[model samples]
Target: MFGDMMGMMGKIKETQQKIEETKKRLDTVLVDEQSNDGLLKVTLTANRQVKTIAIDDSLLEDKEQLEDYLVIVMNKAIEKATAVNEAELSAVTKESMPNIPGMDMFS
Candidate 1:
């Protein structure tokens, strides 16, 4: 029983390490989103850190339109980034989890 407990502890530690590494890797993954008309663009890392935002010169003339475009484009970019981040972390976690009964959180 003690041996099994020790092995499980070690596996859990290893999984934690892998999760951290995966998060770091995700920082390099970029998600790009743009408006339908291609006037506004946003870029974010998989970690959901805003990298850049580009607005067309025409958008500068209309404050309300620019704000609306920003809200839509930014939300889309963040949604994509969140998905990438969650999927990557979930994959790492699911791969490292031990086969213990009732511990199937992913399922």
Candidate 2:
């Protein structure tokens, strides 16, 4: 029983290390999305934090139109970031537990 407990603790420590490493790697991942005409752009980190945005000069004339386009591009960038975050997390989890059955349920 004591050996089993020690083994479990070791596994837990290893998993935590893997999670921390994943977080560090994910922090540097940036997801960017642009509008169809390349007039609007948005960027986000894998953790869903907004990093940057750019708009074309042509849209400066209309605040409402620019705001609308900003909303669309922001949402797209966030969605892309979320997808990337999930994929990164899933890969990390898989690496930690390579042979666990039904692990996809958690990811």
Relative to the unseen true structure, what is the C-alpha lDDT of residue 72 in candidate 1, on a scale of 0 to 100?
95
23-97: candidate 1 lDDT, tens digit per residue: 999999999999999999999999999999999999999999999999999999999999999999999889997
Runs of candidate 1 with Cα error greater than 4 angstroms are none
CA lDDT, every model vs. true structure = 0.93, 0.82
Query: How many residue pairs clash in all the candidates, one count each?
Result: 0, 0
Per-candidate TM-scores read: 0.95, 0.82
Model 2: number of clashes?
0
Q: Which ten residues in a row have the lowest lDDT in candidate 2?
A: 97-106
lDDT of model 2 at position 74: 88
